[model samples]
Target chain A: MDRKELEAKIIELVAISYGKDEGEVTLETSFKNDLQGASVQMVALVSEIENELDAMIALQDASVCETVKDLVDAVEAEM
Target chain B: MNILDELFAKAKEDPQKVAFPEATNEKMMQAAYETGRDGYIVPVLVGDGPALKALAEERGYDPAVFTIVDVADEQYRDEVIAKYVALPDTRLKEKALARRMQDPLYYAMVMQKVGEADVTFAGIDNTTGDVLLAGQMIIGLKPGISTISSIGLCDIPGWNGSEGTLLAVGDSAVCTNPNAEQLASIAISACDTVHELLGWEPRCAMVCYSTLGSGAGELIDKVTEALKIANELRPDLAIDGEFQLDAAIVPAVAAKKVKRESKVAGRANVVIWPDLNVGNVAVKLIQQFGHADAYGPMLQGFNSIVCDCSRGAPVSEIKGNVVISAVRAAGQKK
Candidate 1:
């Protein structure tokens, strides 16, 4: 996936994880500091992303994500 | 100590702290009465208070010890009805508002919702869907859970001639067929549950028909994809798969036969089956032929405290499931 698509997926994932309305998330948003994703939610989101992209992304990797950009970049690197 | 033994000992030591004889069923009442008499948890019976009292008296038991919530013949129905109607989104309120329903399970859910009890166990005669629907409407899912699935605890004596072995199998009663993502999610949930329930750090095996990269098909693809996703989602979690059952759990068998050098080989306590058909049938075979003691199809991922009990569940199973639900709810409490 391209950067834009990856970023969009990250936003959609973050929104879904926190049960917030879509489009509320931005590329600059922090998953832990701003989005408040719990351990289970983080696990679920990574599961969704990996399925959508046909790749694996671990919970520990997702936990260190500070911004949507960082998440997109990390997922891109794995891809 | 074995978790089951510990639980039973706890049940024996402090009977008054637990709730029992939840409803007025003949068998449930009998078990609850006995459990209460043994000092497990306080027995709070829900139904017609006078009728319950009369029944207890007819059965030659003292009714004074059990607290009865008289909804049928008393104004407690309103109190019960109000509890369900207040649920964020449920038909129980509409049923009560229209005066078209009178069921104690809804009241039971409400009781659990309002903290009147620690847990509620039914399904003696109710279908799995019936119990699930009540829980979905009243207790709801825990925040962000997508679906609630069941797990079968399979134990095989001297597995491969060892002392004994335990396996947690899933989606036996809930999902019809799960996708790759669903499979991964179920495995993760099972891992969390096994860790908390059995005190076993989970080594998850995503099982397929073929071992390693030799298999090629949608089935194999699904398992591989699920394993990939599950691995990415919980990196610290000890999970690896796309292997046959032997490759997943038996290290000696895996090393000589399978190609991968997976850490999960032969030591996996959690087995994620391909689909519901495989999952359900495997668990049943293990329980029947393998003589494994199956504890639950305990529903997870829902908001409230709803659990599905087998149609042929004995009183002890009912009591055991109730304890499981109570512990689960207690963990979720704020």
Candidate 2:
């Protein structure tokens, strides 16, 4: 998938996982500050992204992700 | 004897001295009284002897029946504290042990740690956190247990899979989100718990939203990895999955969904949820909708039997939990 598609899928997954609006999720949206992505939500977001992207994103790599863009960047790096 | 009838019988057969530190509370007092009166346990109330006895009288319970361990007795207190501090693997020093012993909960646990009491039961007047903290600092965890978790017995009315209406589910009351290794430890602990407490040779299933290789995710990976780790750590156990609820318990569903020859899939007597979200919710659904009688959220992985009953639990529930604890402690004797 392209960069834009990857970002959109991640945004959708985050929105679904956190029960936020799709519009609320953005590239700049902070996972720790805004999303409060604790272990449960983080695992879920990474899991959904892995399913959508058809790629493996190690939780160790995903743990450092600060925002949606960071997650996308990690997935792209994996690809 | 599967639905705690066996434990109740075992407890009566070899009744243990169980300490109730929060005995001043009527529910705790009543549970202690009833469990003792019924011969499930010899309930020891740890607090001011006079106050407990007076409260027992006020509640129309016979005060003399309970062995009230007076924490204020400096002579007795010092002797017990010294013994506790001197035991192998004791975390606390003499001064710290003595100071913490002033608290009734600590006093009761110390009594157990030193072999005076078989089990320490509380949490009606205390929080789960309180009981757990005291248990960790005072009683300590079992040797192989890396994380402390809980196991509960669910006696579903109509669901008779392996153990005839009784199923064990765990980590619901503790561990918010356990990883693969912690999940493995929880599974192993659950196996030991059911075997020790209920006398069931446990068949454990690491539960998830998937069944075997049917789905994929980090969540599914966690459960599968947990089974791998558990198997590696203790090959004697029958732990399997990444099974969905039905595949874990229902034989027909297991035959359909899981093509592999899984020892645990079709007949899982114990179900270990991936995390607290699943464990906590599944248990409520089982109790409320399935109309199952859920016995515990009882803290396991302790060196001895240390129970933390929900504060909102009724007298009958408290009595049952105490008996469960007593029975578990009895298993330790063997």
Candidate 3:
């Protein structure tokens, strides 16, 4: 997937996991600070992303992905 | 059988009813379901009912199987507030009481206090301090007990210390820098845990760097004084110490270091550390390096049974903790 497509997908997963609107999640939206996503939810989000994209995202890498853009970049790197 | 198996059996026998305030988490809900299905507990999920139901369905569990109590309901909120206000020795202001009525932790405690539930198991999403505070404020302490303490039940393989490889380490996850009196209370609480949960005769050791006054310092003095207080509190229990860890556990070390012919010296299953620094570090070392399966830091000294789980705990660990709490509740009833 292209970078824009990957970023959109990441925002969608974060939005769904945190029960937020897709329009509310942006590239700079932090999983924890902005969305109030907990560690368990973050794990679930990563799993969902990996499953949807069929890409391997290491938990360590996912943990450091603070924002939606970071998560997209990590997913792009894995792809 | 291991300690978990023993507790599971006891839980099945009487099936203590339990409440979980933080039931929104999928892991906790799953464990609650499993424990309920296995006849270990009648699990009551205290939270927003619809949200919990949605989460349960999302996690592939049938919400009908669980008793989800909505704290936000008007009737439930009023009932909890009335119970909280009517509780003896409750010093919470009306504002605080109203706020607490909205908190699921306080609601769970209210359920336990009013015989609506047998025990409360929380701390999956909350901190240990939060759980303890809710427990202390709502449930109150046991009679004559002033301090709240914790005990970690360590199952060390090939180590025949207390009732096989099972041992209890106290004040590890609570009581930061307890005085002699608080330390004594911790020991007594740990002994009660061993007796209640494990069904074992507690042989307690007031562990320190010294082996019966072998070392000289304020720390050794603290352990010695705590041991005296513990003995005075429970004369029947086999309690002794101010011993080193080896002297407390290993018979050979006790023989060489401890001259007294005390029953607890060499065969202590419950070892009370001097402080949190020692107790927490020692338990973690045993868990990581010694490869011991540590079950708790199970909060003790409360009138009702309430346990706190690590935020990162897995479903299996939560299930084990629930069983342990159930055993405690069953014992308290007796």
Best by TM-score: 2
Query: Residue B19 CA error for candidate 3 (Å)?
Result: 0.8
Per-residue C-alpha lDDT of model 2 across residues B1-334, encoded as one tens digit per residue: 4566766787899899999899999888888898898888898999998898888888998766799888889999988988886899665666656766789998999989999999999888887767876787778777766678998888999887898888999988888888788899899999988887878899999888898788998989988898899999999999998899899999999999999788898899999999999888999999899999888887887899899888798887888788888888887677
Task: Give the 10-residue window scoring lowest on summed lDDT in candidate 3 chain B.
Answer: B89-98
Model 3, TM vs. native:
0.76
In candidate 3, list every pair of residues with a backbone clash: none
Q: Tens-digit lDDT track for model 3 on A10-29? A: 88888876778999999998
Give per-candidate clash totals. Answer: 18, 0, 0
Query: In model 2, how many backbone clashes occur?
Result: 0
Single out the weakest 10-residue window by summed lDDT for candidate 2 chain B.
B90-99
Candidate 2 regions off by >4 Å? A1-79, B1-6
Q: Which residues of candidate 1, in runs, are more than 4 Å off?
A: A1-79, B1-3, B11-22, B72-101, B160-164, B228-236, B256-263, B327-334
Give the alpha carbon lDDT tens digit for every residue of B1-334 in model 1: 5556655555554342233323556777776676666555566776666878888888877676677776564366566566656766442344433232245665666666656776666777666766665565556655424556767676675565221466777867776777777777777777777665555677888888887776789989988888787788778888887778877777787886566566676777888888988987888788788887777887776654566666677878777776665555454452
lDDT of 1 at B97: 32
Candidate 2 lDDT by residue in tens digits, A16-63: 877899999999999889987544456456555655566656556777
What does the lDDT read for residue B249 in candidate 1? 75
Task: Say which prediction, candidate 1 or candidate 2, comes out ahead on TM-score.
Answer: 2
Sort by DockQ, best first: 1, 2, 3
